[model samples]
Target chain A: MNKAAASNIYDILDDLPLDSGQVLTGAQIAYETYGELAADRSNAVLICHALTGDQYVASNHPITGKPGWWERMVGPGKPIDTDCHHVICANVIGSCMGSTGPASEASDGAAYAMRFPVITIRDMVRGLMALLDGLKIERLHTVVGGSMGGMQALSLAANWPERAERVLVIASTARHSAQNIAFHEVGRQAIMADPAWADGDYYASGASPDNGLAVARMAAHITYLSEEGLTEKFGRRLQNRKSKSFGFDADFQVESYLRYQGSGFTQRFDANSYLYITRAMDYFDLAEEHGGKLANAFHGTSARFCLVSFDTDWLYPTAESRHIVHALNAAGAKVSFVELSAPNGHDSFLLEHEQLDRVVQGFVE
Target chain B: MNKAAASNIYDILDDLPLDSGQVLTGAQIAYETYGELAADRSNAVLICHALTGDQYVASNHPITGKPGWWERMVGPGKPIDTDCHHVICANVIGSCMGSTGPASEASDGAAYAMRFPVITIRDMVRGLMALLDGLKIERLHTVVGGSMGGMQALSLAANWPERAERVLVIASTARHSAQNIAFHEVGRQAIMADPAWADGDYYASGASPDNGLAVARMAAHITYLSEEGLTEKFGRRLQNRKSKSFGFDADFQVESYLRYQGSGFTQRFDANSYLYITRAMDYFDLAEEHGGKLANAFHGTSARFCLVSFDTDWLYPTAESRHIVHALNAAGAKVSFVELSAPNGHDSFLLEHEQLDRVVQGFVE
Candidate 1:
């Protein structure tokens, strides 16, 4: 996309709703579309990302050399079948990328900084709805995501039940468990603790709080895998030597992996976006929207739901997905639940697996 | 109890072997003795510690304003009652406390720093042998520990099977899992990345890697507890606030908890010590020391072994304890295994619980 087209999303900000008790207004959301929109826009599929993922779900990251976060499941001829489905992957509000968030210009044209209103997951979905309106999409064929993205899929199904005919949530929970919120809190604190974070006014600060962000990533990365996975992959082996020099060094392979994860994450991600996104995720509670009853969220909703969970994903776990399934069943909503066997934990949804691919393709189609 | 008597242990180190082949041995090992050493030293009980735990297992931490790490399970009226068993809790080798570790002085009377050797669980046991000889403790009633300390207990039994009559391994594994090592590596890199580390010679420069050490502790601390424990203690609830500031601050209770844990840890703990201890833990592998035969680690052992694991402890779960139990059973050893219910995860052994307490009390008795 050219800078003019990308910047067009910024210029049209005034057309979108800025306030509804949401912490921020004039929020900019960035997105990308793949495949052609079918006549009537009925073939459109919306893809939501996890806390750190953005609109580049099927493309190479501009800064990092790593592949798109969800390329395994969203590429052409892949699960979501770009050949048959018009896929839309949008950067959620309160995130960096091309999206308008705390780092984006306010009405007066200054970066929102700490002044950005805290956006909720529902607010993000609202922003996405506006984006869809801008794209002239009346209704989506499906809404799909894993982890935090999965949460969004459910939120879209609950708050705007008619937006999609099918909703596929992978490795996600309907509500942010107290444990989930606690872990996210640790990551946010790590980023904020960076001497350079400058109270979320980091854009003009030149250098970001890379160290804190790195630590936060390292901490979150641990929650994304199973203990068995860690054992099989990097069991306490030394780094580049047989003997330890005994000083502060990456003595074990696991420590080295975490450091690499943390350090590499700083390249493409924004610290403020991280803080904002995590807060939004933490504040998300679908059950709270429907008289504190989870089943009520799906009450009378015609959207067909498919919730996928990896057996090893203790962070969200199969149980959390089952909770959603149980709620859906209680509401008598059409939904299918599968606990896919995967050793990769919560990250399993992002990786390439024949079973996961088959499941996503069948569900979305 | 007096300083003069404690200083005598330092003089005896000269008679011990110095550094050789991946082991550090140029300094003294700090320790505490409870109950009287019976005649012939037949009642001696050697207690070990986890990665960060020190010889102050049943004493006060000088900096944190807290009691010993395992005081709940080791003091008077506790499970490992000092009123009955003669307990010897020693700071392991590769530790900062008076232990002969990398942080210890070399023969040149300067901190070994990076020159400290890569020491293993067996090597730590070897250092203990020297301490035992100096104290003239010929035989033991039991050897006990949780996590890393448990590894040392197992190592003692494996290396000198006849010396220990009973062994209690709690929340531990015989081998380092890949994930375990990976987490440690992340922490080490966090410390090393700090300019204050000064290539691990921060000791001479008087500018220690406090930030790195704090970050490392923050990461490792998360693994030491179960999600249930963290959620129970610190949920998404903000610290004395009803709403998030949307800035880089302690917006949630967990962030404040982690920050406190990180900053408070830097006070008494040395950065180099954190590096050395974690490295030792990473090098620990019972089977590797016994000519690659995992069962050989306990070959011909007559010691009664009890391995206790917590169901929520992913770090070293019941499966890991069962792995050790299977090997012990295969070796024709008297071994019992118990999978306890605890919300504390890997750190359950240190918590005040009748289940773990009863197991240790009965096994030791």
Candidate 2:
């Protein structure tokens, strides 16, 4: 894959300060743009991605050779409408996709691996803001995100209120709940437990912890879909052969599907990136950052807000979106909230929905 | 760990047949009895345990030196009161803890390991039936179970209707759903993915898939508790630290608790047995065995059925119990189903509850 066509890299020559009291040196961000920047540069929209999602929001993924995850929503005439607006999607800093993450290099030219400074969602937003600064975009027409992306959007609104004129968050939460942290912890533990992980230093060894990473992906993938969705999609159906295998060999169709997702994910994702990104998500607490009041996060913010949640998105449920809306209301911010009905869970944000399309179209217009 | 004080072994010298058309020879079952059988041999109540539970229902666990799992609900004057009835709890055939499982010895004088025949929930019931036959018990007054144990109770009532006069199933389904199988599959994959698992042949090598098994337990453990319950109990609470560790260590209290649960589980549990038992649960589909009709499973059964489900038990939700109730209604059988409000998710059966006690007491009486 040609680098120019795939993504553009922006280098932050100054050391980027981190919340963990560590400074990241030679930080870089990889981003892709869908539409040309308007002459006034006031029509630019920034799109943030979820965990495991990359900057290829409207382009083909280089490694997977598949259409972008949100291709249906982001192309011309789509919900995101790349035709009229300048659309940009950047790989989050702590992610593997051409970003300055654990898989990136250190000053000594060695892979950072576990040595990379632990970054929070705020830190990731800071990286994106630097990218925005490099592109000479003074303010975004809209900043839209879902799940972790939503976390970043909220972070941007709270920390840098004037950066975006409009903030759209979907299927996301103001903070990670205990259950949320617990699930992510399971994935992290699974990755760490694999012998091949080599304490997150497996990059030099040339053998990634594919098994552990796959298992981690498998576990996380289950949470992304609703139980009803899984039941409808797979049921208790067998994988290939009829009847039960009576052994531990992916007997059920869901097992086969999960196994496929896990293994396929390993081919395109780094285990260390999984660790860093999940950790960042776990550490996210907008209320805590704003001194124990969620409303305080949105205080003195002039950005118009739009929040959306899916009925089946238990990862970050409708209640979480409502919680954010209440905070926005308490802060006296102009915000619109909607809970869409979708069979898919947290993944609904990435999937097609007429209501979501209309909402985005209206909000952006 | 005296044998007499802990449990008794019942040997079935005859070749025991499995649903898979395989024969298991020299099968032994480890069981414990609380209180005494009545003169008419009709006061016996068979208590089935969930996954990871053993025969020590109301007594102390030999390995962990802890009170029995169901001690709160099974002792004198408690629900399933041992004072008024003979309570029999057995470690299911495909389980560890002195049962004939993957850890048990084969005729070749080696641990069966993966060579052990894949057994189903029905096969486990068959082994229990053999144990009852050896004990010269004409019938049990009641057959009670929760979770995987509930699967066995349903299996016993369907396959051998005359074996028990009453069937009590709690927090379980007649058949595992796609989501159920997916979760079990995750656990199995976690175990098998471990290099130490050695394809379930790690017994002779002195290394077990503890890490994988622990991860499996951690994942499954999350499902056993409700989201609200987890939030109430842990809620981003730190683990013996002032703030986030900013590293891969357990930062949240939930993560710390899960890690402890995972690591501590390895000390007393066998990983291969985990695989076998979960496979058995996945293979369970009452409708499939009953001519593609759930009602047919209870067609000739005379047992009074009592199905209990916790409102918060998402693993085996109230709808699953309602499904069984509908089948019982279709079969013209007397059935009582109740969705108990409990905060502890699927673990409500083992916890103390006045309502559950009333139901168990009234049903058993």
Candidate 3:
């Protein structure tokens, strides 16, 4: 664990300033970098991860070895091409990665678990900014992300406007809508229902809260895809044979698929981190930060803004993007918005949608 | 639990033989009679119940002591007016209600659990037919139900066209889609996850798969409502909170609502019945029984069909009703379909909807 010792991102990211007048006294952060900054350091871009995403934005995740989550548009020749933009992706503050979150150790060498300060999106952005400062990138060319990542971008534009020149958000909203927060709450409850969760202190436990975590993931996973996508990909097709079993088992392929997704996720993610990240998102209310005027959050913002929404993404629908456009217009900020048609629901921003790709490419380039 | 059931106006039923070749040993059917039957039994109307509903269509539930689920739509002067029609509702064969199902004891004086023969919607209709035969009632009037109840209605009309003069199906489909089966699979998994499920044999020991059952109900309940409904009623709004606590609690009101729904459901409903009923619904395939031709199910049918769908009902969906309508049309059967706007989603059929009331009234009248 010490081989990377001094170079550990966690050591570098500990002790972040928090909103509750307390410093984040935990571990370091995990991150990845792409492209190169100009002499003015004005070309650096910070990409934030959403729930279940991390520092592997444009590279393979170390543990899972899967392609970086946003690899489709964040590579050297992609939309937020590293060749043109010095991009940086950091795992959020309250995440399972090398971030100072619930899974990390406390000063007393115990897993933080519930002891970690409940973090907000603002807190995450603050930590990211600290990382930027460490990298000597005073101002960024742009900040971009989708879903929770978009929340971070929105947070940055509102709380720290001078940190970027442009901000692009996709498949996200300025605040967690009641339904969105409700979904997260269900997921959290599912995780807690597992006996192994043990009040979020499962580090020394004999087993992981994998079942609860799986249920939580399955519930949230439904919101990530459109009914149309599910139907088209896996309709009432049986998992094995054409005959019905007439028993309580996964008969359809979709059921098995959802189960697999949920179960597989437990291996790489932490249940406590799931609770923390979701709470952070639910607590994110730009209007509240601006004293109840949503527009006020972006008032006097110099960052050029672009927002993208998917037509079928019910989780964070286009209406949510429109609301942001209305607020940005009210704030008189330079902003662009587009709602692209895609069947992937809130996941379209991370999938292949030529129009979305074009819009993001045009906006970021 | 043994009680003499009443005779009904729509008691013109036949205990049609089961296609599976298994005689339901020790069969006991529970049902309710509403209104007065005409001398010729021409006003007899059969009402089916959804997944968790029962034969007490107008009476009070013995467990929750709540009014019959469809009470608002039925009764003396409601849409399915008892004054003009003889309403007969039978507990489905695979349900917990008095009808023969897994919850019923086996010859050994033990709960059937997984031992009960896997039944289908048609099997349920067949059992109702048997109950009707025992009463010596000849049908004329109509058949009706929503969700799974609707499936039974369609099954009745398709398998025994000459029996029901009119079939009124609301928020239903001809066959359970793959997605439907998938959701049910998730639910069954949730129930099985509980240690107390004890391989679905917890009944004799006075143990219940409460946690697993609750999670199942929570997930299914979400499907019964629309996203718009969730957002409008409980959007990101915290349960009695001005801000989030940054922990994994039911921060949003909707989460609390779901938890309440899940936990409260365990108190009255049998977990095994949930599995059995959902499985029966999923196994339903009207076309499969008639040479893979949906139209063939209604071939030479004398029954007039009315299908009512709620626009927001993603569970059964308007498209599902449309498919059935198209099938009936192909068979040259008299059919009427109306897609009504309702925010309640699949459960909308059971709620207050003027159009739904008008549609059922006009069709049955």
Candidate 4:
């Protein structure tokens, strides 16, 4: 796949040094721009996409043919209004959405596949910084992200405080909890367990690990929704049937919903990318990066931080946001935190939330 | 594979009718008895095992060579006290453990596999009732179970009201919630997704869906533990290493633990049984069986009910137990409900807890 020809690619001038002490040569970052940048470039707002997200933040997704994931919040006159801000959303380093990922060709003219260096949230942030340099935007007006994207936002604030004047993180954590790591590990195992996976060398085999990846997606989809939300939305409702089938066919509405989600995901996403991106998330520990103190990560940072969390987001609960707020407070950084009530769990950030829009608009403006 | 020779097998004299309207021509109920039945059979206590549990209530598991799952709760002078009560535990139908399940021989002398009719929680209770009748026990002193086991106890109380005088349900729900069904569906999909599964006819193929089953177990294992308990137990700790492997190995201790759990489970469990059992659990909705009002299930019941829930058992939380308690209260039944503090989540029922032991001992004695 020629990623450079498909999207706006910014080739890094130097070798990209990774957290694992490996170097990525001739790295190309794929990104999409929503609005024009100001003459001074101070109006630029860099948006980091989540694990499964891509560069299409305010437009239609090229693959899915659906509206951009954050289209509701990032269009013209919207919350992160493209009218005033030059919105730039980048496909993260380890992702396969036109980015130089595992599916990308190596210098040896073969897909890197499993040879792709294990990247971290910080490494992803470094990639973003390189993209920013390539675009000649020395400082972003704000850095905005949610979930894995939010991790990148925090990483930018900690590692490159001068890159952004404001930072907004939603429904994310500074470090992956033990449960979080365990869940990711389960997903990784599922993907690798597939015979079609071929130890991540399936790109040339024409047979992807769709079964394992679908199962992995199905498992992850449950964690994205609150129990109350699921109960209200699905309950024990039968799926287009009068009664239970008493067989393995999707009898419940939830089962049908999950099966759809699992199968639909395999179409637009790469299985190897799922492995690499989830690995990056599991390795994300902001405090560990700074000498055993979370506050130290934000030392001397001038970026005004606004952290938003949902009450029912058990995946990255409100406590995680509070932990970041506490760290920011200890570091004496300008910070504001809010735990909004939402029925949709961790996916609340990507959904239609008026309160979240208000917070993002208020903080960014 | 010889279930009859290995355990106390009671071949049902009559055809066993299932909730799905399917009938088993030759059904066998494998059970283990502790202590002897009283002269009037009034001292009999029937214990139903949960998902993945067996009839080895107070003895070692024959397959795993491990101590009985509920050995701590049922023994000489233990909580249930086999010294005074003739304890009986039968592996539920649709389960692999020496019961007439998917792996069991069908009427034509071949493994049922996917050919086995789908069974429900009520269906399982019916098999238990047949077992009781075969033993010439008119009524039991108590019917006790936790998790899926608890579901069976409630079913017996509702359907076979005169079979047991007392019902003790722990860490279980009267209905399978949307979230519950969703998780179970993921597991079922995981197992079915494996190529080696071969539509559940792998009994003759000699290749089991261990990878798929392991992944399924790994996903389910997370729900059985509280986030706090996981943090306290593993907490991002590396597994026998000083630092992250930066690769697809079990780096964290929780990953290692889950991997161990997943692999160990496949060794002792049949993959087809996992699919059938989880499907049965997903189909379990007591209120639906009783015309949408949970209280209707317990109407005119004479059994004394004791409901126990753990503070951290998110799978079947205290609210689920309270729902049952409310229904029992509305029915004007003799019922007692307690929500105990435990950090182990849904698996707390299987873990040793002093409070639980005391409650069981006091209630039984």
Ranking by TM-score: 4, 2, 3, 1
Q: Tens digit of lDDT per residue, candidate 3, span A112-227?
A: 78888888899899888888888888888889889999999999999899998899999998888766776676677677777788998888775778888888888888888888
Candidate 4 wrongly placed segments (more than 4 Å): A1-5, B1-5
- Candidate 2: where are CA atoms >4 Å away? A1-6, B1-6
lDDT of 1 by residue, A23-97 (tens): 444456677778888987899999999998888878776666568788878767888889989999988877777
CAPRI tier of model 4: high
> What is the lDDT for A131 in model 1?
84
Chain A of candidate 3: what's the TM-score? 0.96
- RMSD values, in order shown: 3.5, 1.7, 3.0, 1.1
Q: How do the residues A230-328 of candidate 2 rate in per-residue lDDT, one tens digit apiece?
A: 988998888888877766777788988999999999888889889999999999999999999999999989999999999999899999999999999
Residue B84, model 1: lDDT of 73
Whose lDDT is greatest here?
4
lDDT of 1 by residue, B37-128 (tens): 66667778899887777777777765565798878877676777777777888777667666666666788887777777666677678778
lDDT of 2 at A84: 88
Task: Give the better candidate number (1 or 3) by lDDT.
Answer: 3
What lDDT tens digits, residue by residue, belong to model 4 across residues B40-105? 889999999998888998898888888999999999989999889999999888888778898988
Clashing pairs in 2: none
DockQ of each: 0.40, 0.88, 0.54, 0.91
Worst 10 residues of 4 chain A by lDDT: A1-10
Q: After superposing candidate 1, which stretches have Cα over 4 Å from the reference? A: A1-11, A15-26, A64-67, A75-77, A105-112, A198-206, A235-256, B1-9, B15-26, B75-78, B100-110, B201-208, B234-238, B243-248
